[model samples]
Target: MYDLGDIVEMKKAHPCGVNRWEITRMGADIKIKCTGCGHVVMMPRREFNKKLKKVLESKADQA
Candidate 1:
């Protein structure tokens, strides 16, 4: 499972030319911030699962 502050790679690239995003919030919906353009988007977990490529780093990993 993904938690807040995790950096992840998406299956597709963002328009801003970044595949990396940081998880800012989690619940029934998930909120992620784009690392390149700094855009924030909120979507359901199912949609997130479809879009996510892999978890690059988690808070624990960073620590």
Candidate 2:
């Protein structure tokens, strides 16, 4: 599961050419910010799960 401040990779790279994203918000909908262009996107949790490739960096790992 992705948490706030976690870095993740998506199945598809964003138009900016980066697959890295940071989890900024979570709840019924999760929000992620693109690391390449600072773009933010909000999607349903189910959709997010479907698109998520893997967690690159977890909150626990940051500690």
Candidate 3:
């Protein structure tokens, strides 16, 4: 499962030309930051799950 501060790769590219995002918040809604444009977005968990490709980095990875 994904949690806050996790870096994930999406199946699709963003307008900023990035496929990676950093998870900033979690719960029923998830907030993520674009690695390319630094834009932030908040979406429901179901949407996030649909867009998610893979987990690149997790909280444990930081430690």
Candidate 4:
């Protein structure tokens, strides 16, 4: 599961060639920033959830 500040890997790489993204915002939609090119993308929660492959880090675990 993903939450704010989670670093996740997408099933496919971004056009910028980065598959790793950081979750900066979350709600009905999820916003992620590319770890390689600093690009940002916003997608609906359902789609994002489907595309999510791995959770590299969890914000909840930081506390």
Candidate 5:
């Protein structure tokens, strides 16, 4: 499972050739920032779920 501030990998690489993203906001829509290019993207929770591959790092774990 992913939560705010978690680093995650997506099923497909981004156009920037990076698959890792950082969760920035969460709600009905989730906002993610590209780790490679620093580009931000917002998508519906359902869509995010479908594209999400795995959680790389969790905020809770860091705390």
Candidate 6:
């Protein structure tokens, strides 16, 4: 499971050529901000779970 502020790697790279995203919002729908071009998107929890390849950095890893 991922929490807000966690860094995640998507299974596929975005149009901006980035696969790293930061979780900014949570709940029924999760919001992710691209680390490359600062693009943001909101997707349902189910879809997010499927697209999420792995958690690069977890909330616990932060300061």
Instruction: Give TM per candidate.
Output: 0.92, 0.95, 0.89, 0.89, 0.95, 0.93
Residue 22, model 2: lDDT of: 96
lDDT of 6 at 12: 92
Off by over 4 Å in 6: none
Each candidate: how many clashes? 0, 0, 0, 0, 0, 0
lDDT (tens digit, per residue) of candidate 1 on 1-63: 678899999998899998999999999899999999999999999999999989999898778
Per-residue lDDT of model 2, residues 1-63, tens digit only: 778999999999999899999999999999999999999999999999999999999998779
Full-model lDDT for every candidate: 0.92, 0.94, 0.90, 0.92, 0.96, 0.94
- For model 2 the TM-score comes to 0.95
Give the winner by lDDT: 5
lDDT by residue for model 5 (1-63), tens: 999999999999999999999999999999999999999999999999999999999989989
Sort by TM-score, best first: 5, 2, 6, 1, 3, 4
Model 4, 1-63: lDDT tens digits are 778989999999988877889999998989999999999899999999899999999888998
Error of 4 at 38 (Å): 0.8
lDDT tens readout by residue for model 6, 1-63: 789999999999999898999999999999999999999999999999999899999988766
Clashing pairs in 2: none
lDDT of 5 at 22: 99
lDDT for model 3 comes to: 0.90
Candidate 5 wrongly placed segments (more than 4 Å): none
Give the poorly placed runs of model 4, Cα more than 4 Å off.
none
lDDT of 1: 0.92
Per-residue C-alpha lDDT of model 3 across residues 1-63, encoded as one tens digit per residue: 777888899888899898889999888999999999999999999998998999998888788
